[model samples]
Target: MKGIIFSEFLNLVEDTFGLEICQKMLDENQSDGVYTSVGTYDHRDLVKLIVTLSQLTGVDAEELQRVYGKSIFIRLYQSMPGLQGQAHSTFEFVKSVEEYIHIEVKKLYQNANPPKFTFVSEKKAQLIMDYHSARCMSHVCFGLLQGCADHFNEQMDIDMQPLDDDGTEVRFTLNII
Candidate 1:
């Protein structure tokens, strides 16, 4: 496996399972340094990293398999919506290469007491709307339609509407609930 492929697989895992899981995997794989190293890591390293971390973390191997399998299907769908083809899925091949590193964050503070975790209030929808409105203007001016729409929808959960049939500039109003 190549470095690019490994990075992509990590991204897919992060997108599907969330950053915490991927971050933990990186930590466990001593290869955490690979992230900083100038392109020394590759896809084979990534596969090994995930598998070793999964084993250490007690996250079922089967669960990781299901997630990776589904990701492959989604990628295929996006790349070739109507076309069908048979290919050897590199899904697992990418999961088998890195050595796991397991650093317990709490141990870092064993001498000093760990701080208590607390929940913070989430920003209101109206605030999110205001932020997007400002962002949308910048994106439109820069001709980044997809980026603008993605940010708008993510922050406000509202689809952008084209200002005209030209499909150049668009607008979205957040519905506060």
Candidate 2:
């Protein structure tokens, strides 16, 4: 995981909850609470933060991750100016993740271990995204898809299923509405 993700997650917590709660979370967490956008940290730290927040808020980790992902997309849109003015539809943008966004990310951080995403199907009304990651952040991916739809003001019907029972490999089907 990257420090920017931790910073963003904390930011979302603070904005949705309060600074007091956010500060308390950081204090309770084993992490030192110092995060630099370009810095990388253990993925377990992020999982801990989310789990703690879930315990505090009585929100499931999956739901929290989904919301976090959806909101984070807004920040991504603002930070990546190259994507802001582009006219690609939401589905188009989602389809470009592995080829465009992840490629750029790897260029900046050669050691970054990004998830592998393959667009199994690209059609006028539907898309099939195959997500494979050791980190197992499919809930976040769902949120990202929702955020993309929201960003483009497009209504989408999305269905997610794990290829295996463990959920390490998942498939996402997006049908534009």
Candidate 3:
């Protein structure tokens, strides 16, 4: 996983659960909790932090992942200038995840294992995406969609379809309602 992910996750933990819990998590967990945006580490480290936060806050791991995904999107949006203005709507933004954002990510980090999103369909008010990622972070993707809705000040109706037992493949149908 990318270092920015860990850093942002730590920041999210600190922001959501106060610095004390964040510190305690770092103090007790295997991770050193010192992540640099440009470094890379084991995905387990990230999972460890998430699991710790979930235990501390009594939130389900999946729910925390979703919220973390949403929080990460805010950081992503703030870091990448004009990303919000480029998309006229949340559907367009979600559709652009693989085509645009991942492309740019590859330009910066060729080895980065970002998720693959295939455009499935689109209608007047809905868009469908087929997602595949070994990371099994579909809930995070869900949160990103939710965050996009918030970014555009729009509401979204989203349906999740899991295609495998591991949840590596998921279909997300987003409605701008």
Q: Rate the local accuracy (lDDT) of all candidates.
A: 0.38, 0.86, 0.85
- The deviation in Å at residue 140 for candidate 3 is 0.9
lDDT (10s digit) by residue, model 3, range 1-177: 778889898888888889999988887795578888888787877778788888888999999999988878878887778576788888777767777888898888888888998888889888888889998889988988888889888988989999899999999999878
RMSD of 3: 1.4
> What is residue 62's positional error in candidate 2, in angstroms?
0.3
How do all the candidates rank in terms of TM-score, highest first? 2, 3, 1
Error of 2 at 173 (Å): 0.7
lDDT of 2 by residue, 98-120 (tens): 76788988888998988888889
Q: Give the 10-residue window scoring lowest on summed lDDT in candidate 3.
A: 91-100
Task: Return the lDDT, model 3, position 25.
Answer: 86
- The segments of candidate 3 whose C-alpha lies over 4 angstroms from its true place after superposition are 82-84
Q: What is the lDDT of residue 102 in candidate 3?
A: 84
